[model samples]
Target: MAPVSLGVLASGRGSNLQSIIDACRRGDIKAEVKVVISDRQDAYALKRAEKHGIDAYYINIKDYQDKAAYETKIVELLRRYNVQLVCLAGYMRLVGPTVLNAFPWRIMNIHPSLLPSFPGLHAQKQALDCGVKVSGCTVHFVDEGMDSGPIILQACVPVYDDDTEDSLAERILEQEHKIYPRAVGLFAEGKLIVRGKKVFIREAGND
Candidate 1:
């Protein structure tokens, strides 16, 4: 099968984006990053995409009159690049309905803490504040709600009693890098099945 084409959106330093790129290059994922779009002009994610000779674009939200217009432009670019999958890697803004309707369950995101627990930013800090014994990373299908999507995969890490926010975040980030690529690989391989709020993983050659 041909490699799946991916469109990535990021707003900050894109460690997860880098992980995907490396995974594709290493043949660990049957996908290729066709284009990268960033809301911030100075996003390092753009630099990372350009470094790998991938098409990178900066779409300023201010340039568009409204959120819908902004996402329409994004959808245009994604379609132009024939992007089959959309990945949000450190993208700060909430995804509007325009984009959601355009891709449906084809969108994916990686969250720092186990989702439905600490979402909408500062997840590591939230875990520490809540005194959770285990914090983890989750890769899930994107939905209208904040990190409320159906989970595809997760990796857990023990929270140390003396762990600071950054310490916990670092451990979660390591897991994020691993599982995010694995989740994308599953999508590229047509091994993900979404039903209601649950995502089922199909075994190889089962279909």
Candidate 2:
């Protein structure tokens, strides 16, 4: 089977992006990262993509007139790569209508918390502050709302009594690396079903 083409959006260190790349390299996922794009010019994600011979782009959001304009440019970039999937690997920005309409359920994001509980920034801190006994990561379909998308897969980790934000974040990140690729792999295999706000996974031979 031909590999699914992916367009990844990321900010910061992009450890999750590296995980996806590593999975592809090992044939663990039937997909190829066609492009890696970042709003910030200095994001290490671009460097990681370059190292893998994948096209990397730094599209400055400030160059555009508005959010719509920025997302329009991103839509064009995805078109250029014939991207089948748009994965958010630590991308801090919320996706607007332009890209959402273009990709619809095709976009995916992995968040640092179990979601519906802690949706926005500093999720690890939120979980820790809330004094939750269990906290982890979630891979979900991206939506217009902030991390209010349908959950795909999640991994739970215990919140130790002495755990700091940094320590909890580090552990959740490990689960992110595992499940994000698994979610992408499911998408590549045509095993995902998104109905309303729920996501259902089909058996391998069902399709």
Per-prediction tally of clashes? 0, 0
Model 1, span 119-201: residue lDDT tens: 88899889999999999999999999999999999999999999999899899899999999999999999999999999999
Clashing residue pairs for model 1:
none
Worst 10 residues of 1 by lDDT: 113-122
TM-score of each: 0.98, 0.98
Error of 2 at 32 (Å): 0.4
lDDT digits (tens) for residues 1-207 of candidate 2? 999999999998899999999999999999999999999999999999999999999999899999999999999999999999999998989999999999989999999999889999999999989999999999999999999999999999999999999999999999999999999999999999999999999996785
Best candidate, lDDT-wise? 1
Segments of candidate 1 deviating more than 4 angstroms:
none
User: lDDT per prediction?
Assistant: 0.96, 0.95
Task: Give the per-residue Cα lDDT of candidate 2 at 59.
Answer: 94
Question: Candidate 2 versus the native: TM-score?
Answer: 0.98
The global Cα lDDT (0 to 1) of model 1 is 0.96
lDDT of 2: 0.95
